[model samples]
Target: MEAHLRVRAALLLSVLALLSLLARSSSQEIQIVNAERRIDLTSHIVKVFLTLKVENIGASPASEILLAFPPTLIDRLALVKAAATVGKRKKKSYLPLDVNPTELPDAPNGTKYFSISLLNPLSAGESATLEVLYILTHSLEPFPAEISQSESQLVYYRDSAIILSPYHIKQQTTFFKTPSTKLESFTKVEPTNRAGTDLKYGPYENHPPYSFSPIIVHFENNNPFAVVEELVREVEISHWGSLQITEHYILKHAGARHKGVFSRVEYQSKPSFSGVPSFKSLLARLPPRVHSVYYRDEIGNISSSHLRTDPRKSELEIEPRYPLFGGWKASFVIGYGLPLQDFLFESPDGRRYLNFSFGCPLVETVVDKLTIKVVLPEGSKDPSAVVPCSVEQHLETKYSYLDIVGRTVVVLEKINVVPEHNSPFQVYYNFNPIFMLAEPLMLVSVFFLLFIASVAYLHVDPSIRK
Candidate 1:
């Protein structure tokens, strides 16, 4: 009996060992041929682009690829787009891609993953290129975090100098582009180069997968980093004559807050105080042929606002009631009018259509949340809209002057929007001609009935006695 039990145990151990060997041999590995990372810090927003060449080296096909970021950046990161292209195609057509976050057991704190699925499974020995674009919000930190009003501001940014990948990297390069050429300080790596406002790092070779090298950059950026916490843009169409646009903004200064009370006398007397970090005014470029421009804040009209118009373009310059220091908040509204001929169209089928476009705010900044509402004429129907960014849409009705039926309102909401989203949003809708003339026809009928009633009353005269 003992001999039989020993034989059974030995057979089970041998089977388990064989299965382990098979699992190890069948495991697949991916190789990164080259990587390029570009970081642009021109405005208040920070943009990052990554491109990679990858190959599947295992026996089986690769259907998915995974990429991760440092735990610290997971909350501040917003993915803009991701795509992939198969081997060396000159025409440059990108494959459809879907990205989602995946949890990693190794990085327990927090790690964001970008998973991309290929249309055609990447067979063994086949290669493809992958590209990723994203934005970093509130990533710039003021080195001091609090500064006096008269001091020049210095901004610091920290990031990885190497590409983060799950596959072995054969070669890689990183480029950091700053807004100004006045770079104060940057970390020096063994293999790096620089020219003008661009700092380049490596064509590094033979790096194990999932490697990281941290870097910090300090530069002179005196520009006010304004962030619009929320913005509401409304467009009201008046088919009778013109189109009106109004925008309300909740703006905030994103730099370091003031440490002490501001001294107006000291600021005026010293030339050095001129370098204080505060937002005084903003310039907005309006569409051509706009009129009736107005700028005001919660307190009332801002008299410091000015409008400049030429044959070529129209500009509006507005000054806030007070200089916006760090952590300070302000709210304001700006409105203008344009002729209807610019946006209305009549189809050959006798269908009336209104097409309108709205662009981003004129201020060079980032908007965390934006809501745009377009109000169409009464009795409008079958409305449609197209916006370049991702948005949630809804429809509502609004009542205004002389309106028998409320106008159709289209509301669009977007999050984490940047200045590059300046692409105009186009909207189209149909209007009934009968509804357009309803108000005029009703007014005429009321007048005609009143005249007839007055004549009848006069014909029936009654005598009065004193």
Candidate 2:
């Protein structure tokens, strides 16, 4: 009988404990719902649907709803597409995808369901979804959204993947056949979902455009979105593994956050702008055994940047053109020397020739109209040179430097784009192994010929000339 009584007492205590736990968890069952997706190609934009799901623990709907918004993915998508739409960046007030980051410690009982999206900014409802739609463009997606009073913004591939292809680029009306300029051809684009996030790039079937797969670089990407209305990068490859690269950056603020006229005071006083680096300047890595680096631009000199290298680690660190702000502009230049041996590559048959031509990108502009010219090395002897692959619709020939007719020149022009030009242009040309060497050879040959002529002239006796 005593044993039975103990069992009954234990069961009573267990029941009481269960009731208390249930009371505590009664408010934790709130859920969010109403997720949607939308894409507008007419304007070139995308939007996401989000809603809150709240369950009434007290069996009663809440009196009000308070929702917190997050701006984490804003730069990667919606806002970026919107920036591509229209000619210029849409006013932030007019933009559909602007949202502030929100954190909710504990949701109160009076609040109910919330619907949010990039479209609708705010709504008033109890136990209902507050949906808002968002929009973005490529340039705005570049980060460091705003910098301190005086700082440069550094921008590059932050949230996506790269797809390279191997193909001889097109030049005006012909093709330049070469190996170095081949693209890492891409075929198809694939996207996968790993939870709430979707990824697009590759398990990579073959290569780029064909064999190459899209390379997605998703990270905390704190860099700012910037567009240099102008940029000039000159790379010189010389003897003894010496490579010299000069960067001239003319940058303008291209962030999606600019709402109205510029605010210099607010931008300058901001602590982040004063300390953090913007995407305006970048980190350049050179081959081994490089020394004597310089950074400058059209503005003469920028003191904000510095460079350092450790012989053991063999690394090159560089700073940017200017401190990036919400809607400001600046220009600067930089130069660094690298080893020539590192640049020398060998073919299957073992041949040597100087390869110095590379490429730049198409800067999406709403203003339209642009002129760009690429100056190749003096001895780029091939009669044909492959042009860069970009949004180029028309191209023309320009003659300059030294040539019988003129070095093959290509001019590309187009407008109304956001920021896809950040990629490199693939170009190739069959270098004249013999002719590329001829410039210096010809110079030496001329010098020797002149010397011999002088000697002959002196030895010929003035009497013979008379």
Candidate 3:
């Protein structure tokens, strides 16, 4: 046993050495010719766009490019997308590429990397321009933590002034666009410039690999930070032509906490200025051709909602009993019905499936915990689910109206959900169409028994005849 352990340790050491060698060799082969980064800080969500010009400097061809992020941002990063440009000027077109997380044994400073696979191998001395869009959530800090209803919200954002890269950058610039011109303070690195609501970092030249310069910006932003602590969506399908959807929400204001008493009179009278950071209403987008929509809570049905329907989609505008301030929370439910033909389809092999949205419908809102349950018809068997991203899934039994053995529920749970997670997922199962007659047959049998009893009672002789 001791000899076996020694052999395993030696093998691990050799593998680590090989990985380190590969990491060093790749960094020397590629270089960033130019880079332009734009960051939008208008709302609670942070969006960054990077346009990179890359060239292969070594003799070998390069098949992928590495993207680096600091340890602080690794968990908060929501989505990253990359696309390569073709043609020039007005004729330019973009081809989407795959982006996946990669690990290196010799990373410096706990750095993380995402590799973007190119369409074709980049030959030596050949250059390509790639555009990447990444999103981050909960990256802003609420300064002073608590404030009165009349006070505007202030936040602090920290990031590196220089772009984090494993390859040397010849020239690069970073630009930031804020919601307003209410700047408090910002770090200046000699050439940093602030004009209106825009801030420019640098057009600096000649930066070595793994360069980083930290900076911070403090500014005033009054946008609402609406966050859903948890959202549970349940979908029930009926072969009789209707699809039912119900969503339960626990929404909270994730901004600075509200201090002192909330004065409703001041908020109502001074709508333009008072309670600038608080939100009174929210909008949800639903699929087109929705019907029987309702918004309610434990108290009763909520009457303060308006729904507009068009050929493309339906919009629901709702208001809670009170405005949501910092640290405040509200609970409610939204239910709707959709035509089965729109979302339910039968495959070539005689299996039925449901294609539905995966996350919350509110605009510009973040959900920390999300649970989706797809309740298939009562007689379904051999269930399966397909989702683009990773999710925890399990099977459950749910009893509904007229169900004998209970319906099969496909439960999917995910955390740290953003708007990018609102994609379609499918649940497939085998179901026989003959089982649709079960409910009708049961009702018919009950009526027939009642009819026979009524006829026998009429024909019975009473005591008067005796």
User: lDDT: which candidate is best?
Assistant: 3
Off by over 4 Å in 2: 1-225, 234-244, 255-292, 299-304, 308-324, 337-426, 449-466
Model 1, 34: alpha-carbon shift in Å? 1.5
C-alpha lDDT score of every prediction, in listed order: 0.78, 0.38, 0.93
lDDT by residue (tens digit), candidate 3, 1-466:
9999999999999999998998889888999999999999999989999999999999999999999999889888888999999999999999999999999898999999999999999999999999999999898899979999899999999998899999999999999999999999999986899999999999989999999999999998889899999999999999999999999999999999999998999999998888999999999999999999999988989999999999999999999988999999999999999999999988899888899988889999989899999999888999999997789999999997777889999999998888888999999999988889887887888899999999999999776853
In candidate 3, stretches whose alpha carbon ends up further than 4 angstroms from where it belongs are 1-4, 446-466
What TM-score would candidate 3 get against the native? 0.95
Candidate 3, run of 10 with poorest lDDT: 457-466
Per-residue lDDT, model 2, residue 385, is 26
Q: Which candidate order results from sorting by TM-score in descending order?
A: 3, 1, 2
The clash number for model 1 is 0
Between 2 and 3, whose TM-score is larger?
Answer: 3
Query: Candidate 2 residues 269-308, lDDT tens each?
Result: 7746543333444444443455675556565655655545
Task: Score residue 10 of candidate 1 by CA lDDT.
Answer: 100
